[model samples]
Target: MDEPRRNLVRWLLGGGLSASLISFLYPAFKFMNPPDVPEASVNEVSAGKVQDLKPNTGKIVKFGSLPVLLVRTTETEWRAFSAVCTHLNCTVQYKESSHQMWCACHNGLYNLNGQVVSGPPPHPLEAYSVHIRGDEVVISRRA
Candidate 1:
């Protein structure tokens, strides 16, 4: 091939290689550094009815865009806390047999009061006050 034709071919190959590299690296970078999202402000949320959640059972409810885990420890006692784990933000659930919150992602454990019990969680789950109004379960952040 002529000198000009050879130069054109080299340029095209280099451009394609660079584009391929960028395409692969871009997603890896994004996966490592996820974009930040503004959290929605929520003061109170109605979880459900007291009669529906039996003692020693739990349910996940929506508080804005976040998941709130509500547990009924006794017939007269209910607890609510943020379901997101503090370490990696994994969703947590209540383990009825153990009577604790458990994060399946990392085996993080938390008590009914949201205090970290074991595993990789660095902070306790955010606690919410539970109020029973006429048969409805209401959860709200502490003042």
Candidate 2:
């Protein structure tokens, strides 16, 4: 083969191999350390209607990626708290019988106001202010 022709083929092969490696590695690197997705700024969350939650009952509402527990302590009183367990990041639920938030994963207890009552929880659940807009229940982060 001519010298020029040999050099051209070598250059093309190297370029092709480099492109192939980059194509395979780019996705792997992305998967390992994925880019951060911009979170939607959520100042408040609508839990549900007043009738949807009976007295002394609890419901879970999505506040961004995490869950928020909404509890109706009385006929007119409503409360909201972060549903993620402080101990292990487990989702918590409202136990009507216990009348408080309970994390079944580690037996963590949080009061209606989000204070840690017992178990392995290190801190209290994040509390959100509750407001009643007619029939709808509104929950917002405290100032």
Candidate 3:
């Protein structure tokens, strides 16, 4: 074709190819090195009213972005622990039949004090301090 027309077509093709390459590489680069996001500093969180959980039962509460497990072992006794399993970061639940925290992902077991009891868990669940203020149950990180 004409010389000017050929140059125009070449520029258009080069621009399109660069745009496609950038579109593909941008996401891959982002996925490989994600932005650094600091975790929210949470000192204490109000779980709920004491009456919300019955004796021998457990409830999961959100502490910042993490899940905190609150177990009412008895009418006057309470315990709080991290709900994440140490094995693979799986969420853990209370098993009333066994009176312990159980991670179904690998059958990891933890006692009332958040101590690893059995299974493949490499470390004990983090324990939190439980405070009873009037009718409210508050959970806080230990110093």
Top candidate on lDDT is 3
TM-scores for every candidate against the unseen true structure:
0.72, 0.77, 0.78
On residues 1-143, what C-alpha lDDT tens digit does candidate 2 reach at each position?
69999999999999999999999999999899967999998988888788998999888899888788888999999888888898999999998998989999999998887899999999999888999999999999889
User: What lDDT score is found at residue 11 in candidate 2?
Assistant: 92
lDDT of each: 0.92, 0.90, 0.95
lDDT per residue as tens, model 1, 1-143: 59999999999999999999999999999899968987878999888778899999999999889899999999998989999999899999999889999999999999988999999999999998999999899999888
What is the alpha-carbon RMSD of candidate 2 to the true structure?
5.4
State the lDDT of candidate 3 residue by residue for 48-140, as single tens digits.
899999999998999999998999999999999999999999999999999999999999999998898999999999999999999999999
Give lDDT for model 1: 0.92
lDDT of 3 at 107: 96
The local lDDT score (0 to 100) that residue 77 gets in candidate 2 is 90
C-alpha RMSD between model 3 and the true structure: 5.8
Which residue segments of model 2 deviate by more than 4 Å?
Answer: 1-31
Worst 10 residues of 2 by lDDT: 41-50
In model 2, pairs of residues that clash are none
Give stretches of model 3 more than 4 Å off: 1-31
